[model samples]
Target: MTVSVAALIVASPALAQEVQPVPAPEPSQVPLIRMAPAEDEQVEEPQDQGEDGEPASTELPPEPVVAIPQEWAPVPTTPEGRSAYGYYLAGRSALASGDTQQGAVLLQQANRLTPEQPRLREQAFTAAILAGDLKFAAGIVPDAPGVSPTITEAGQLIRGIETYLADGARKANRLLAERPVEMPHDRAATYAQVWIAAEAGDWNRALAAPPADFDPISTLVARSNRARLLEIRRRYEEAENEWKELTAHAVAGSLFRLGYGEFLERRRRGEEALALYTAAIQAGQAEPRIYLAQQRVMNKQRPPATLRYREGVAMSLRTAADQMVAQNANEFAAVYLRLSQQISPNAQTQAYIGQTLINGNLPGAGRAVLAEIPPSEGPLYANARAQRGMSFDKSGMNEEALAEFKLAAEAAPDDAPIVYALANMLIKMERFEEALEILNGPLLNTADQIYEVRFMRGAALEAVGRRAEAEAELNAALALQPNEPSALNYLGYLWVESGERVDEGIALIQRALAADPEDGHYLDSLGWGYFKSGKPEQALEPIEKAVAKEPANAEINDHLGDVYWALGRQKEAGFQWQRVLTLDVDDKRRAEVEAKLKDRLNQLPYDRVAPAVVPATQP
Candidate 1:
């Protein structure tokens, strides 16, 4: 998602005209059945080197490792059982390939054929939930008896939600209250109680103050819910006061501003509502609904009123979903998001679901969710396409990523984020000239002054051996944003590596470190700067710290080896150099590392001098 600075300079004004609205793919056309390669099976491309010789792409954080079951028991061998087993395998394969819809269908078939098979039933349930087929998931609850506690709880939650959606609040509350012990610490369940009360027209109880023990988010949600209910009841003054109090917090999100704006619009305060809408948009809240309302207001059209009851329910679910995401309860979050979507189907809700899936590392599922947003929803469509590009990039489908970015850029030619994303991808692909052309041509006359574009330009300049221009661009970037860590780090490392302005380099690096104290790359640069300044001993601690923080980083490892050799720890240096060979270093760096491995201390570029011997007789 990191775009090159130069590439981001392009004025994509023509891009929107070039992009046409595209329809979502049919379920049958969606290529969800493609299986991702296993980690061992994946062939890692050599990381591109940046201007400072670091990896061009930011390294993705390691995914949490989960233990897979070591064995699978053989399926039944009877003719009917065998047939079911085949279907089950196909279903699992489909799921692995990201085709949740097909997977669910196939798994459902398998479950029906082998009604007694717990594994088949469980898988079918999982697939259905992942596909957002809650109805199907609800139907299979009966078949999941005596399964794992997690599965049982999931079934209960699904059934509970279905009952709530189908029956009235009374029936749903009765059903949910039966399993209070199961959700002892469940924030969602607690919020649901408030929502049910509000649904049943008990405004006083619904607005009742939460307990002291309630979490900050829960407390905020409670207040917001009460305000929303007040607005619904046309208590304008009370609602206005509540909204002002809620939005006064610096941490208040777009949702609060949106609610307040709606309230203002409803009360015939056009200008005030428009100001709030503009502020929300300026604050980078890109939800389609907000943009539509803003446009409507600008044109003196009436902003549409959403049903207050549905809004209340959606808001509660959204708050719970946010909590679930914070807890890393991805499935639970998905369920809440899906429920919200069912009630509102707003662009904000859809975007939240897609983003949540992406954050959870379910890019395939995330792309599916994003695709559901229609192109007619301009803001959401552009945002979704950009996100889809990111998903492709994360999945290692670079070409597809490029295409998606291009599509998004065309759709919103003036959108800096999309243009920057496209350019960044090009930089990652090492198409430096193309990236530079975009920056210099389309972006030359553009008025937006983004520091990221300058920094990326500097990187591209360095990549193409235009060091002076790169240095100038970097300086320009620093001038624009003095404390930008990437620029400070890059420029500092460049000077340090070239054995120029050692003290200034060290100072810049220190500034960067002050900004981001735990950045392993910055630490390595500081250590390297020390070594370059003929203070190998001073380099030792920082280098070791950097190595400790990023043990697998090839550059850090190599730098450590150099520091060790300078300190006369030849054997330790050798081990570190050998370790570099096992890492994913670029070809040029690998060659240099290999040379160092062969020659050890002799291959190092440091100016090592023996200590002078003084005659004792002089004293």
Candidate 2:
């Protein structure tokens, strides 16, 4: 199951005091997940990050893999089945390429030809919804046990929403009320009632009792929902009280802060909103979202909340999309997203739906959605451009990726996060001078810089051969955030490689390893530290284990070869060095690897591998 709405309305810090750690997932799911720098980990509400940034050495994770099927089932052999199979294959290809309109057409044709195949119909219905053909999807909606499309929840909800747009609220509420009052359907129906009643100008029913029990996640959303409705209904006191309770308890600088502050601004309480944003910033919530909110208020916004009933219903649909997308079957969220768009087209919704499609591996559909956003939506357009860069990177179109990032940076030059992101892509592409210039630029050269800025700048400096400067920057980063494992690993490895503070470097790497035992980079750093400290004997085991964990890593393999050679395993060392040449090493590393294989090798006396021994470096 997806934790959608819950992901959005996070339990406040106080509510989250008794946090339970999630259990580890299987290693198969971690197919190469990070970028070279911290900015790659952009926190988008909850899921914004470069999905294609990780090295293959990074152990694949299983969590985000969720329950998506990989291979398709075989099609039947009858005449209609074969024709439908061809159309299905073509439609799937079209969808993968981001041509949802044609894809939906082809998929619907396949379903028509293969009416008995439930899966085909499901695919067609999904494509139709994603293509914004809601009525068509609703007409052919399947009745499954889950939101994959049960009439009790998703199906009835979609149908009712369509009805409200066509036949009005009374008729829609009648249909919505008929859905089985089960767990999810009960909640969906309750939300539907409020929106429908609001449309009919019935405040009593609109502010009815809780959908079910008041769980933390639902309660937060429910309070937010009730407060918004209250304000819309001109019940000012109740709305203000509700906002107070939420602001007091919300996770610092969350979207709730944004929502509440926006509400205050619209109510002509600009000073109060400014105070809220200021408090959030002073409380160590320096996120751009809060800064943007403060900027909006200072510019003198208009007074009092004024939105039509349709707009209210559209906002509720956006909320429902957030909830549904958090589930494992996130593709279904597009149903709600498209429906919301049909009612009220906005850049925020388009960006969100676009991102959802991209993250869910529907890059074609995602790119198409993102492309539809007008450039007039300043920051939103810039973000969409960045996402396009990510999509390009994932597709191996490196030039296109960099170009898109450049466009984003140019468009939002003052947006610190976007600047950092462009620099990140440059660093990854070995365009270090360009990246260093950006890092050293005025926008990022502030005194109280975040750890990411410091660490990434250190990395860029190191790449451009500024040794002492890199170390000092990394030290500044370390001082800013002492327990950050990535910073520790990078600085430790830098020192180990340059023969500076080797012993202390070993300790730092050990700390990094302790923080994340499965990190291949940390393991390699530990082994390299041992070798640099003149104990190749101590280096063998961790290096070997590191190789096992990341067999495809050129650097780790090179380290293993050096360890093997020092221990009299000369033949194996030569084999390892030869293998490094075939892996994706840099040109400089390739030259060194070639020299090692040719001039420096003669087999030694050792005929077998030595027994493993634990290094003192183990934490």
Candidate 3:
């Protein structure tokens, strides 16, 4: 169950670089920094030779050095300013250390103490927003004039959101329109206008033609908002037409289908609703609501009442989150996702939030979010557990990860993804037999991931000395995915080492090298193959290159030593063998290498050329 070198090498093509003569040094010993030329030094251009051979012009004058003022105030003259400065420093330190909550609190204190300080107020506001304390951010908007334009716009947006939440759509709309807070590209302001119009029951005004400058996403949002309003108002025919037009576009994701399904279900078209829900699921939608709706339709029961307004809001937020994710604004995306979750509380939203947290390097927070997914969401709960297991595995908590994976496997026994995850964990833990059993039993029938299952099974079989079965499984994997590098490398190396199908093995390894010429491990395999085929001369260059690329690799070093021994370089052979012993090799390999060093040469099973004679003086 040990992860093979093939597995590691196959995952990264950069590992396959051609070995050069000079050994690659360890990272710590490599000189990475380049010294820059001194600032005051000037480069002299070459001059034409004079008739008397007097070389160049006179030296240029040295640049004058300006004196910089280094003096500063020894102490703050005012007590309040001193306290505020102290709090600012502490708050910035906390924020730099990733304690956003504590930083926000401290910065807010500093802002309160220095009410006239625009920078302090802005820092406190930004920290609060990043900490997801929108209310606090809104409350702390500086009343002082002449603040930064960016901060002012942010303050306006925050106040607008607060008004929307506290006093409903009409007041929020009036406030935003009056203030006219301009965002870059006006995305936020445009969206707010559309949603507020819809919420205010001005369907005609809301459905009026979108502005000429609206981007595709904003246009989609506006149209979808209109369709949703129509659906809510029971204008079924117009709603269906609008939805049909919207969903025809590729950007209309699963949310569109879900909305359409809700529309169909409310109109007593159960079959249509069920079909739409099924289509959504097939399109990779994992929202629990779709599944629940399908179940209700299947049972001939009426679906739950649609929360059209809330759904519209959640969809808008989710769309914004998607855009944010695309732009690599992970923290902002997480905030938008959380806002969407508050409105909808669906499994997909929860999953997005958890994964976003993980991507933002908050694995513990991600796992916590996944763990809170309720059991009532059957498939989603299983998926969440699987996600949680991956988070734990990534964080190096193996036993906890195993526990989570097992729980997920039990909950969704037929799920290929969960089964694969569990099998991978088992393999990593050296539970090869259990891993083989899982892959050979339930996963054998999984059509979607059959190739992966076969590949893993091949590796497991190879680990347990069932070489024939392993070969067969690898061949099957290749049949499923032709030229699959991992399978090709493993099978080719095995064939060459075993002295079976030597020609085919050489060809297979060549094909793999063709695909990834830089792979050092594959180069090693090709070199070994040549040596075993009684071509030590041909084997020398590749083996030398392999060793240079993977300077400390025990297996490659041993191969290099064998090649060297065959070529009559006994002393160099001994050096390579000794180097192998110093590496983290297994006990069996260590003993074999030690024996090779002591005996000067060992009888290898494969055919090789006789060692060349060396003079006694050649030390």
Candidate 4:
């Protein structure tokens, strides 16, 4: 039931452009509300730029406004003594501008200066929620001065939002249970009940809440919540329909479409997914979740699309951009990344920018971006090291790439994922002994990584020609995850190669293909399944699909060559084998492909073929 790529790609672009953008106020206009200054002021003006060497004005700047005391607006401050008011204004401005770090800092300073200031305290509460620092928001919610019961109630509602974000609704619901009916924060109390019921897997309670009254901007939030609730209940068809409704009814400038787009992507509607994602990107609503989501979709496509949007953007912008990308619009992620870089200079962004460049088929550009961070010491350094290793490996510098992997492995010794990466890299270098040591030692001991360790151990053994050991390890992995596709394909393909249990191996590959219908590697496995069964003609379709999905995969291209040769298509077979030789295949495989190409060329008749060779396209 997979939708053809041709149908998805041909959809109208105008329909995609209809989703709304996220609303943002002009940069120069600061929303000002007053809070009274304490008699003892300990205000510290935010310095122009901190020692981190990032941009100073990338976040909110400080400003002054009128002071309010005892929950009422006080007289405006004189020019000479406005630092306290300035801190409050600056903090709120920072929060509104999506600069949570600066907002947090400024709000902290303002809270210290005016402990009894309700407006200042409320702003602090809002900042914590927006920053996703639930613990901080919880602390602030209990102790604020009641300056008008409504403001205090708003504070209480945020407390529920924080609790929901942190401990899920179970704890939040228990907390609300102790409150009396006359509690000052009923609205927040009601919302907490809704959140708790939904999180506790009770969709009926969540749906029973009064219809949400949201401003244009907040309406997006409401719709997203509704969509999530429906998704949680496993009402997928209904959820899809809700998303469709939201797409049509959501305001043109609303950010809710990111979530809807993601729903389409998860359903494997790639064309619709990509279109919605691109709309969000073009509307300047690129979020980090969107980028990651879109990347997942692209990875599942016939021809893998680049996932580099918002790679170097501010964390907030990156988050938003990722959300949009996740909704499936990876092509515009670059805009968010570049904008984040322009706003702030940080190693995290640099690493992302480099990775994005690599995904875009610009390994040289990736290296150039990474080179800017001389003597890398942070997360960006590790990221740059990984990218540099891939670049070196691609350029035929296996030893150099191994050194980089070693550095990355040493830097994050306890991280099982990094260990797996290093072990995989070692296998590629044909250093199977070293790979075996790493996987059998550290990776095996790590919790939750046992399956991956066992899988890699099998690969290492197979690379070193330890056939019996490889089979045992792969069999053990299958016992843990019976339908694990990588293990299934690898073990099945190995059996095919050895001409043992040919029918069983072919069935295994077909089952793997069913699980991951669009995966290029799995497609190649299925094609090889046909070849092993002596059905060369039957292998052609899957082989062609595999090549279409992963143009740069050396092994898939070689498999295609084998299929062509079996079909007596000598010219195409030679071209494919030559293409494999041009890629960064392992030394042994490279030599084998070269030998196969030469053997086939010699068998061709002198006058039957044209003199000039056809341009070879590799996997």
lDDT of 3 by residue, 79-117 (tens): 545565566678777766556667778878777776655
Candidate models: Cα lDDT each: 0.71, 0.72, 0.69, 0.60
- Residue range 1-619, candidate 4, lDDT tens digits: 1111112122423423543332221223121112223446554322345578664654544344334553425533435555666777787676554355577677767666676655566666545433334456557752332233433443454454445455756665555555421222342244335546665655676655344442332233344455555665668887777667666753332244666766666566778887777777776656565676567666774423212111211333344334323333322233334434544557666666566555544455456566566554665566577677877788778887888777766766765666677787888777899888988785454555567777888988897889899998898888889898889998988888788877888877877887889999888888887887889899889989999999888999999999898888988998888778667688888778877866767633222447887889997
| Per-residue error (Å), model 2, residue 342 | 1.8
177-222: candidate 1 lDDT, tens digit per residue = 6764143124555555566666766666566676566655456566
In every candidate, how many clashes are there?
A: 8, 11, 4, 35
> Which structure is stronger by lDDT: 1 or 3?
1
TM-score-wise, the better of 1 and 4 is 1
* Prediction 4 TM-score vs. true: 0.40
CA error at residue 235 for candidate 1, angstroms: 8.7
- The residue-level lDDT of candidate 4 at 257 comes to 60
TM per candidate: 0.67, 0.73, 0.67, 0.40
lDDT value for model 1: 0.71
